[model samples]
Target: MIETSEQGDVAVLTMSRGPVNALDLELLTAFPGALSDVAGAAAVVLTGAGRCFSAGVDLKRIVDGGPSYVAEFLPALSTAMLALFDHPRPVVAAVNGHALAGGCVLAAACDVRVMSGGTIGVTELAAGVPFPTVPMEIMRHAAGSAVDRLVLTAEKLPREEAYRIGLVDELTDDLVPAALARANALAAAPAEVYALAKQQLRAPAHERIAARRERDDPGVAELWSASATQERLRGFLSRLAAR
Candidate 1:
């Protein structure tokens, strides 16, 4: 589910799945550990192995597990995202292709993101699912007014649109190379100072995330477990397969 390589002080972590990289339990379980192991690297670049970056969670898992699956699934994934957000060094998403659903959330959680013009952002909220609040917090912090339109509607913002919305930090045809170069630059900075600066940078968002967790997570979790969400998911999956 992951491929790791060290380039000087930078660690490149690639999501390994053919075509569109979909997140399954295997990915959720493996990614956090892989990220933890590479914590020593001054910077980390997250990309994909094939044509696309990641398409988000596996539909098969959701179909089999039902609505409760989201409650269980999101918390675990959130733990991973939290680790990335709190990691000492910079993390960048190298968006080689489409970044949809949880994939978009993952990209947004990173310190910076670089995308090719063809990449996409799909939240799938009309399918009756929502991203973890932590990632929403990141989006709210990073994109400001852009978050209102993006998150509220759960629209799929294409690469250029995303760039205009400030969801992506940079745009390039050679995403991987550009992201790697930025990672190298970050890695070259003093580690202690970088860590402190990043911590300070994320502090406000972290605080808001914490507050949202205490105030709203149970309701959100309940929404995930609701019968309405299950019905919607079932219909959505059927439609997806049909297409």
Candidate 2:
């Protein structure tokens, strides 16, 4: 479930999907609507329930549900990512712990990212999953050119390194408190002005990737459901099971 609370002008959205807060079909489907509901808040703080922020999508679910699941899941995932990226309000990520794959993309999509513990990374390639164009664009915008290397290598960076590479905007010992403070500060700006400025800053990314998202998303989903990708997933699952 997604939990919401108001801290002064700052609204908080907590990912409470349990344990690792895996971004499964349900969470992906509900995420955008949840954010839309809190759009009226001056600023938003997004975080997870426990130690870890999110472990990304549940590969097992895709493996079990097969092609139909991949088709629906891919679009939902893309929509949720785009929602966070395009949200008019200043959205901050209180990254309390490890945020891998889709989770990392979520943090990157936010206007500001404040991380406290664990690590953050794009592990799509490592897991033998293909990256859709939208996520690649989001990460590139967040972390700059270094993002290309990380995506290719699946290197999980510690908080210091993440901050260094611009994957996170700030790092502090207290995640929520720091993020809430940042959100409160940003909320002080005039609503329309801030929204417009934020949108302007994000336009380049949106414009550049417009055609690609329309093309890549469905294609990647089909690729994920392909026999070869399934074989790779089987190997990935086997490694997970062994662990």
Name the candidate that leads on lDDT: 2
* TM-score per candidate, chains pooled: 0.92, 0.96
Error of 2 at 16 (Å): 1.0
Q: List the residue pairs that clash in candidate 2.
A: none
RMSD of each: 1.8, 1.1
Model 1 regions lying over 4 Å from their true place:
none
What tens-digit string does per-residue lDDT give for candidate 1 at 1-243?
A: 799998777899999965678876668778778988998887999988887788877766776776567657777777767776777888999998888777887788788889985556656676777656786786677677887787777787788888887889899988777998988877777989999998898889988887788777778777767777778888988888899
RMSD of 2: 1.1
lDDT tens readout by residue for model 2, 122-183: 99999888988888889888888788788999998999998887778898998789999999
Count of backbone collisions within predicted model 2: 0
